[model samples]
Target: MKNVYITRIAKFLPNEPVENEEMEEKLGIINGKASKARRIILRNNQIKTRYYALDKEGNVTHNNAQLVAKAVEGLCDDTFNKSEIELLSCGTSSPDQILPSHAAMVHGFLKSGNLEVNSPSGACCAGMNALKYGYMAVKSDQVKNAVCTGSERTSSWMKSDIFEDEVAHLEAVEQQPILAFNKEFLRWMLSDGAGAVLLESEPNGKTPLKIEWMEGYSYAFELETCMYAGGEKLEDGNLKPWSEYPADVWGKMSLFAMKQDVKLLSENILKKGVASMKLAMEKHNITEDDIEYYLPHISSYYFKENLYKEIENQGLHMPWEKWFLNLQKVGNVGAGSIYLMLEELINSGKLKKGDRIFLQVPESARFAYSYAYLTVV
Candidate 1:
């Protein structure tokens, strides 16, 4: 079997780190029940500081294209030729536009003409999917070099009024939709970051992580309605696209109209995550003991203990102490998370040459999961 190696990794986080207190103030979650609810969400998530693509006044400072391009450039050797990159795979929860594709936009920023590009935008699993594509492209000998990027500008969507309007028009405050209730919850939970990795068919003296195997799974698309944007299934069983809403909900809401069932998500994500891990281990012909480092792209610290418990309940156990988490520092950055985690571990200089890394990536919107086994070389 041919091999693909991750030869380089880079990350771009814009602006200063924003703490929970500052985010709460910006979102006006001060005083009353809103304040209490904000505290619970922040404390439970354990996210202390996260970056945003914001200017000094807290406005969006960069778009998805700029963020991804900067990250990819960071991975480049100063003397490297840009044209050697045969493929560009990009993934993100939010994109600059729907037509040109995120990958195309990145190519434009790099001023590289006609290099192949793919935008595998599968919500949160998107970044992993993008990496998987680049890995296979090199493993199959189709590309000598490929760039895989994942970026999220969630702050752009954080200020939407759709959810607030839902609260304002509620027949009773208690009857407000989950979207309304959890709107500000995610606002404080999400931030901005971009991560990229350079995949090469052969390692050229650079430290590389040899890719052993990768697997992905998506269970029951019907569950997609559990978390989504641009549409909603009301309590009365009617499907309402953003267009069905009032005029104010038409433009920005169409781009960032998000709704989620927190209860259903929490219940299913753990089960699906463990199942995916089992499948990955089986395919890679490994056991929990084979793994030296456990890296999971989880959404929050609230789910950390639950994930471990589920892993044990599945009749398998991993070295929990080997697990690494950056959510407290960067928040849930969607697709950019896994690469950022890997980057941190690599830079920490802790792993031995032959160490095995178990990577778990779970996406909430589609209830999807991806796992990869990598070996340090």
Candidate 2:
């Protein structure tokens, strides 16, 4: 079978690292019960430092387009002809605007000519879909080469001052003091980064990895309301206008206002994720012995142990030593996580020729999953 090769990968971090303590101070949860909850979440998540598009005072320094442009630029060097780029696929959980597609904006920024552009607009897992689309386009002879990018400025969401006050109000109203949408919770969890890959139908002498097979599955859209941003849905599944929004709904109506049911995500993730992985493995006749590296894009540290156990239940017992995780350094970068993680592995220079890598990514827009098999070349 003709294979799609990853000729090059480039990732860009917005700025300096933002430590947990610094985030705490910025969120004004320095030392209290709220701080304690923040600490526990961080400790369990295992993230140390994450980059943000922010300045020293915790203000957004870069917009989504700017961050994505930087990564796309990195992917293109003197040897890479921007003209030969036949397709561009851009994915993001947070786009700069809703009018012009993010892919179009990126195309405008890079001045990449009138090639087909696809914007897989949805949750974080959209990244994998964008990449798969590019790969398929090349493998099917629709294009000679394609550039796929996943970028997010989740920190852009953090710039809102409403969350801090809203949390306080929610806590005060409840019978017991409870944290709700607290900055400390998300400040340590989300991040800013962009990653891009140039794919080709034939090896360019710069190819580092060859995608053997990629599969994706979607289930649980019935629960799509569990995690959403930008708008509120009415009882009949129609979006309510901003003017008609109720107080509860109005409070959550910012550019990056995300309302999520953490409990729902935790309960359903493993079952759905494992099912998706098992199907991909069975289809490809893959097993633990065939895989050298297990690269998974998990949303949180809380799910790590359970995910391992679920995979074990499937009778594939790959040790943690083989698992590659980068959430500790970059947090969950939404659409950018998978590419960022893969870029880290590639840059580590640890992969040997012919090593098999298995990638798993699950998105939380009510659960979509992507699994890919790649071999180091």
Candidate 3:
């Protein structure tokens, strides 16, 4: 197989950065009261700033597809223009619509040219899925180059209006003013951003990151849903999607709002992530010693120590200095998180030739993970 190189990396962050204190002002307070989980989540996540695709009046500035189109536009240069693209693979947890795939919307926005496009939908690992698809497409000689993107318009879903009916129902019935922690906490955790990279058979820059190997794993066979949107978890541990329920009750139950099983996530996320990494390492016949820069896409800094403990227990312990993360600066952009981190690291002028960058992407949506090895050359 031919090697796939990540040539040009770019990101599109809409509007100015929103501080921790300014979140509720833009997202609005749920139940007309401040979220009890916001402060704690912000403190633990250590995210000082994040971007939103909405204005102060809570109006959308860019849709998910537009965000991706903007990011893809940033990839164009004298060396590679939009017309030169042969494949466009996009991934997102939040799409503007469900019918036309995310990639089609992106292509429509770009008006770059008619090309093969795909959209992989999920949580964090969706971005890796998009990258892997493009990587394989180039490596298999199906195309000379491919453009892959990951983006999220999460702010639209996190706005308080989405939960008004559910919060109002709770206030009317339970007399409690606070929204559910599962849904409310995410409002503080997610942000909006889009990132893109041009993958080619040859390196475009002096220090292009070459994809060595990519692997994805799913523990969904053993674990139930840990995080979800547009659905409800039934008593039997199965999800009831938004379409299954009545249209009127969707707002009442906040069926379209994102939710998580916090306890389940804490118990299984790190444990399963490292366990699956071990399996991937075995298959690749590589060890931690083979990597120089470790980039793990984590939603919160609170999980940093816990994740390290899990790896240490498995004898795959990596020193903190080897770890690189920007969650504190970018918050969590879900599927786009890793792409933003990679864009920053690659443009940071830190990586040199022959460096090995290892990516660990874990999605709590259902305990799926994606790992990739990239070598700077």
TM-score of each: 0.90, 0.88, 0.98
lDDT of 3: 0.91
Better of 2 and 3 by lDDT: 3
* lDDT, candidate 3, 198-251, per-residue tens: 999988775688999999999999999999998999989999999899898999
* Of 1 and 2, the candidate ranking higher by TM-score: 1
lDDT of 2 by residue, 1-377 (tens): 36799988988898788787877544444214444566787888888888888787766778887777788788876887676688989999889888699888888877877799999988887788899999899898888888998888877565446454455555567733344442335656788889999998776644368899999888865554446765654566444445565656455334246656566677788888898888899898988889999999987888889999998886767788889999988888889999999998988878889899998988876688888899988
Provide the overall lDDT of each model, using Cα atoms, as 2-decimal numbers: 0.79, 0.78, 0.91
In model 2, the runs with Cα more than 4 Å from the true position are: 25-36, 164-185, 221-224, 232-249, 252-256
In the range 187-226, model 1's lDDT, one tens digit per residue, is 7677789999998867653468998888999885556456
**Total clashing pairs in model 3:** 0
Stretches off by above 4 angstroms in model 3 are 174-177
- When sorted by TM-score, best at the front, the candidate numbers are 3, 1, 2
The best candidate in terms of lDDT:
3
Per-residue lDDT for 346 in model 3?
Answer: 89
